[model samples]
Target: MRILLVEDNQALAEGLSTILRGSGYAVDAVADGASAEAVAAAEAYDLVILDLNLPEMDGLDVLRAMRARANKAAVMILTARGTPEERVKGLDLGADDYMIKPFDISEFEARIRVLLRRQAGLRSSIVNYGGVTFDLNSRTFSSQGVTLDLPAREVALLELLFLRAGKVVSKDAIMASLTGFDDDLSANAIEQYVSRLRRRLAPHGLTVKTARGIGYYLETTAPTA
Candidate 1:
């Protein structure tokens, strides 16, 4: 999934970004609330990890502004304050979950999973489509009881397509989610990856259809076994 992390702590942000990416998530991180607000407003993010203390604008203000604009992206507050008042305030301000600092990485990821699941209206961690089963926690794909190994970027791409199956996902959108706003990838990079993905899924009776003059779509048809 695509995530926006709004944190001023450089060390923590880098660490979390690495971990989340390794866990098959596309993460874009900013060190201030204003940048966070801008990125969140402009991009399509599956979730947002917001810090309460920020430069330019406080995280609460950012959340309030996002909600005011009817940005329905799921938000989780990351703060040092673990007090009841702080938690209540964040929730009241529209934060979905709150996590205090010095938290366990596994627990943090678990909370993120919960928020994403809730957003997708999913009750289970495993997402099934056609004959394919995707293990969100393991980042593994299995079809017809055969496991398919996919690299991290490919896995993230597949997850994005599956989450919005049948919708046209633009090349720019895919690039932004995978490479972040600061990185530069070649224009043909997404096409190359999509081509590779289509080859891989061909055996499974699924395909990534390119919408000429548009982008790509994932469709389920009879397996070509």
Candidate 2:
């Protein structure tokens, strides 16, 4: 998943970004609300972790602008604002979840998982497709109770394709969600990863279909002989 983290506190932002990336999320962080708004507008993100007290523009205004521009990424207000009015206003402006600062790290990550899953229209943490099962919490793929050990990038790719499921995900979209701002992966590299992932899934009755000039999508069922 890709996340846009908007926080003015450099220390907190770096810490959260590291944690999120370690958990298999591609995160781009901005220290101001204006940059947050611009970055969020330009990129496709699965979630936005926003801080209210921002330089130049307020986070609520950022949220408002995002919704105005029809950015459907799940927004989470992660700030020191703990008052009822602040929380209500953020939610009224389309924030999916709210968290006050000095919070528990475990709970913060858990909330993010729930919001992302909700954004993907998944009702549960466990996803099953074409005889393969994925546990979102454990971030593991299994088939018939056998756990498949995959490389980190492959795991991220699988989760991305699994979340989008039947939709054709473009190569640009895949690169954006899988690679960070400073990463140096190319389209050919992405194709290699996809090919490797395809082989890994084939034994489990899963197929990764390419859409000609577009991109790729996970087939919903096993291919017929």
Candidate 3:
């Protein structure tokens, strides 16, 4: 899933970004609320990790603005303040969850998982589509009784497609989900990966179809051979 992390602490931001990436999340991080707001407004994100204290604008103001604009992305507030009032204010401002500074990374990750699960309207970690099953925590995929080993990028790509199965996912969106802000690769790079996946999935009666001027779609019904 794609996430926007609004944090000012350089070290903490980097560390958290790394952790989220390792967990198969595409993360874009900014040190201030304004940049965060801009990016969040412009792009599609599954969630936001917002810090209450920010340069340019306070995180609460950011949350308020997002709500005013009807941005429905889930948000989790991260800050040094653990006071009841602060937590209440954040939730009232439409924050989905809250985390205090000096928190456990494991807990933070668990909370993120919960938020994403809720967003997807699922209560479990397993995502199943077209007879393929994915274990989110283990990052493993199984189809037709065969387990396939996928690299992290492939896993992320597959998850994105599966989440929006049958919908045309643009190359730009795939790039954003795969490489985030550090994408320097050609647009056709994603096509290469999709081609590889198509070959791999052919035996399972699934295929990735390119939509010419649009993007790609994953379909369960196979073409006539």
Candidate 4:
């Protein structure tokens, strides 16, 4: 998953980013609300971890601005404010989830998983379709009783494809979501990754269909006799 972390606390931001990266997510973190709002508007993220108390612009203002611009990415408020009114205000501003400060890391991670799954129209941890299964929590991909040995990039790529299964995923979006904010992975590199991932899925009754001048989509198939 690609996440934008908006936290002003340097120590907390570093710790959270490290933990998020360790869990196989591509994260772009910013310190202040202005930077967070700017980045969120300019790019696409699967999730946004926002802090309410912010500099330049208040966190609620940031949320309102994103929603005003119709940015529908899942947002979870991570703030020190632990009040019902604050929680309600965040929700009303289009936050998908709320987490009070001094939170359990495990619980926060679980909430993130839930939001991602919910966004993908999934109601469970495992997404089973077309002879493939993805364990969201474990970040594992398995098929036909065998888990495909895939690199982290390929794993992230496959997850995105599965999330948008039948939809046409533009190459630009794929590149942005799979690579980090500072990554210089070229368009050619993305194509190479897609090619390799295609080969791996082919034997398992799945196909990555290319859309010329566009991107790719996943379709299921059974091996022919």
In terms of lDDT, the best-performing candidate is 2
| CA lDDT of each prediction against the hidden true structure | 0.86, 0.90, 0.84, 0.89
lDDT tens string, model 4, 1-225?
A: 789999999999999999988877899989898998899999989899999899999999999999999998999999999899999999999999999989999999899999988988888898886888999998899987788899988888889889888888999888888877877888889889889987888778788889998998888887433
| TM-score, cand. 4 vs. native | 0.93
Cα TM-score per model: 0.91, 0.94, 0.90, 0.93
- Per-residue lDDT of 51-87 in model 1, one digit per residue for the tens? 9889999999999999998899899999987899989
- Model 1 has an lDDT value of 0.86
RMSD of 3: 2.3
Q: What lDDT is obtained when candidate 4 is compared to the true structure?
A: 0.89
**Ranked by TM-score, top first:** 2, 4, 1, 3
TM-score, candidate 1, is 0.91
| Index of the highest-TM-score prediction | 2
Rank all candidate structures by their lDDT, best first, as comma-separated numbers: 2, 4, 1, 3
Q: Please, what are the lDDT tens digits per residue for candidate 2 over residues 102-153?
A: 8999999999989988988889999998878999887899998999889888
Off by over 4 Å in 2: 220-225
For residues 1-225, could you state the per-residue lDDT of candidate 3 as single tens digits?
889999999999999999998887888899998898888888888899999889999999999999999999999999998999999999998999999988998899889988988887777898777768777666677886678777777777887787778999988778776766764657777878888888777766667888898888888966334
Task: Judging by TM-score, tell me the better candidate of 2 and 3.
Answer: 2
Give lDDT: candidate 1, residue 50.
92
Q: How does residue 127 of candidate 3 score in lDDT?
A: 78
In candidate 1, the residue pairs with backbone N, CA or C atoms under 3 Å apart (3 or more residues apart, or in different chains) clash, namely none
